[model samples]
Target: GAGVSQSPSNKVTEKGKDVELRCDPISGHTALYWYRQSLGQGLEFLIYFQGNSAPDKSGLPSDRFSAERTGGSVSTLTIQRTQQEDSAVYLCASSNGQLTNEKLFFGSGTQLSVL
Candidate 1:
C-alpha cells in the first residue's frame, strides 16, 4: 500500500470484551506508532516501535492495553477488558526511522466503541 492501512474502521464491543486493532504501515517504513483520540481530548501516544530496538511503551495508559509489531511490518493493538472510557479513535502512523525524517504517514483510525 502507498500509505498506512488499518482494519475494522469501526468496532463496538461490550465492556468486558476484548478487541484487537491492526495496522499495516507503508512499505520500508521502520518506525511505527500507535495513538488514540478520545472525545474532546488530544491524541494520546500509545506505543512506538522502531526497527528491531525495544518498543517504547511508556505512553500506554494501562496493563490492559498492549501492542506489537510483527516482522517490522504489521502491528496489532489489543485491548483487554474493554471499558466505556476506552472508546476512541485508534490511529497508526509510520516513519522512515531517521531523526531527520520528520514526516509520518498516518492511517485513518479505527473507531472503537465500548458499550
Candidate 2:
C-alpha cells in the first residue's frame, strides 16, 4: 500500500457489540502501532510491534481491547463487548523500522461509536 488504510472510516454500534477495525500498512515497513484518540485528547499508544521483538501491550485500557499484527504488516484491533466509553477514533501507524528516530505515517482511522 502507498500509505496506511483503515477500514470502517465511521462505525456506529450498540453499546454491547463487538467490532473489528483493520489496518494495512505501507510495504516493507517493520514497525506497526495502534493508537486511540478521543475528543480533545492526545494519541494513546495501544500496542506496538517490531520484527522479532515482544509486542508492547502497555497501553491497552483493558482486556477487552486487543490487537494483532501478522507477517509484520497488516493488523487488526478488536474491541469485545464495547462500551460507550470506547467510542473514539482508532488510528494505525507504521514506521520504517523500530529505530527510535524514525518518523511515523498514520492512517485516517476508524471512527467507532458505541451508543
Model number with the top lDDT: 1
- 105 Cα displacement, candidate 2 (Å): 0.3
How many clashes show up in model 1? 0
Q: Measured by TM-score, how close is model 1 to the native structure? A: 0.94
Q: What's the residue-level lDDT of 3 in candidate 1?
A: 90
Q: Write the per-residue lDDT of candidate 1 for residues 23-71, one digit (tens) a residue.
A: 9999999998899999999999888889745458998899999888889
Each model's lDDT: 0.91, 0.88
lDDT of candidate 1 vs native?
0.91
The 10-residue segment of model 1 with minimum total lDDT is 96-105
lDDT of 2 by residue, 3-67 (tens): 99999899999988999999998888788888999989999989888853436999999999888
Reference-based lDDT, residue 83, model 2: 99
Using TM-score, give the best candidate's number. Answer: 1
Candidate 2 lDDT trough over 10 residues, lowest sum: 46-55
> How large is the C-alpha RMSD of every model relative to the true structure?
1.3, 1.4
